[model samples]
Target: MTRGLTPSVHAIWQAMGLVPPPGPLGARHDFTIEDTDLILRLAPDGQAATLEGTLGALTPDPHEATAQLRKLLRLGLGLAGFNRAALVLPDVNGADAAGAAALMALADRRPDQPPLRVTAQARIAPGDPRAAVAALEDILQWRSFARDVIPASAEPATAAAHPASPATPPDSGADFVIFQP
Candidate 1:
């Protein structure tokens, strides 16, 4: 409904090897899933999947483009007859090494299904904890809706429960507890 966005995502799904590549009407080029009049081009300025309108190489502002992408995906829920779906935020383009590795691990180990993946890394040093938290929150909200609305599958928490190595004990200091997700 939003700028013919659903099929665009489908195009991306195809491009990612999550779904088979589209026929003559679709093909991969540059970084986007291309079709006539529309494109699900990977966002170049920031994160990926920042869907935008293209006209002779002109692109909308980054924030606006991101909003449009969200709108388009929401439209898919009703039109695609999918009430619930898992989102897998691929650890592609945006994420750093740790975040990317974690997501890749999740994808590799989890069942094959549509789960949104956000590549934001929270715990990685030099990373913004807030951004990581925001990404985590987004994943939770979507998952709640999906469980209530649609039948789907997901990967188990790969990094959530794993224990980190013990920090070096301070000399003559009391024991401290470390928490992990």
Candidate 2:
């Protein structure tokens, strides 16, 4: 049996100095990438990732959303991109790493730039389909400049919607965990 692996990417990336943004301990957190305004959320288990935004320069045509999703997300990054891009570090490899760095640099030089804006047609409006998108994004706050993402330590939620959910590893304490997804 392996003796040095755990299920928490947070623990590993933190050890490697690739920190994510500050978030609640034990509670899954979200990130708003300052460079592109991409909102990323990791699954409760930290194995699956979801990226949401107004669509970037490459995703301008709504018809290309799915293709862009595949292309942009084609990075072999897994949690690496999550830690670096979200935390504003360089990914070891892949387009996202470059994008992450670009965003980080942009954040530094144009610190005042507003969150990357979605196209005009994509704007959320009353009775608009995109309204759902707006609702989802409204929950994210630029607490830390998207590039200011840092290492996260889990804090068990006092109350959870899923009471039987698996507990978050106590800091770096999940020695016996393995993620199948």
Candidate 3:
């Protein structure tokens, strides 16, 4: 059998049959312009692919659901006119070659901008729709001027009740991890 080439941006592009050269990696993550969507994929050692979601459809509100989404999410999604923009948050705790490339892609797209930093506070209110609504408010309150605020909701009893389930714990202190997709 023939030997396979290593996974580089060029190789990935060739694999995708794209003619244009891939851009250098940016602050958020290295992304290649494919059609209308910006794609960032990572397969780091000792770490799962933490960021692997897409931004698309260029909607007034691109969220799959309103309650679970953060209010400031629009800021990130709407920053560019395109319907889809994806950034993969690399696991920087260890080796980050792939992560670095991804970040570089983000930087390329958002030059001179901070790499999508985010901070959030969530509260669980049982049997109260308002709790979810409040969570959105909290996201806006805690959000930095540069970053977008994302409002979320959750149910106290059901694990999935929280509209914004599967959040990266505060302890992780992850700036932004794939936009809660």
Candidate 4:
């Protein structure tokens, strides 16, 4: 088993049967999984890494955007088996942004189009190369689900039409059930 050493993103890439980008192992790299573009940045200490990519954008309508934002937040909180990833919306200045202040800025600035860009990030632990690959795959899966499955507007009737599924298996002995839409 791999241990003690910092996880190598190149190793993870090769393990996933993809060619590593031409660069030093520690450098940030951009790659694609299932046609979804992703950026990988390793921590300075090499103890961890982050995989981030844009999933989509929030709806232009205020009410719809609010609802969409809430759902994205819930997904980031690990709701609906999407715990492997977190959603982020960077501000105009490109700083990590969230909550009301960011929302207000997004609203005030870009009224004609979807102002808030949604990104999904997943943390990769050190040591095991498989873990990093898994994290990348998980984020890609969740990205696809978010873009295809999640509705732009959360209508009561539309929400009720699709029931949620349990995140865990029934006989797993877990006490709680996480329902994903």
lDDT (0 to 1) per candidate: 0.33, 0.32, 0.32, 0.62
lDDT tens digits, residues 94-162, model 3? Answer: 465644443454434432322232223233233333333333333332332222222211111121234
Highest lDDT against the true fold, candidate: 4
Stretches of candidate 3 off by over 4 Å are 1-8, 19-29, 32-42, 46-53, 56-181
**TM-score of each model, paired residue for residue:** 0.20, 0.20, 0.21, 0.61
Model 2: how far is 121 from its true place, Å? 20
How does residue 40 of candidate 2 score in lDDT?
Answer: 35
**Which ten-residue region of model 4 has the weakest summed lDDT?**
152-161
TM-score (C-alpha) between model 2 and the true structure: 0.20
Off by over 4 Å in 1: 1-72, 75-126, 152-181
**Top candidate, metric TM-score:** 4
Which residues of candidate 4, in runs, are more than 4 Å off? 1-7, 44-46, 77-82, 91-102, 106-114, 149-181
Give the candidates in order of lDDT, highest first.
4, 1, 2, 3
Model 1, span 103-145: residue lDDT tens: 4444454423322323111111112223322323333344344
Mark the regions of model 2 whose C-alpha exceeds 4 Å error after superposition: 1-28, 32-34, 42-47, 57-181
Query: Candidate 4's C-alpha lDDT?
Result: 0.62
lDDT of 2 by residue, 107-177 (tens): 45442322222211111222232332333333232212221221112221121245564677558576775
What number of clashing residue pairs does each candidate have, in the order they appear? 12, 6, 31, 0
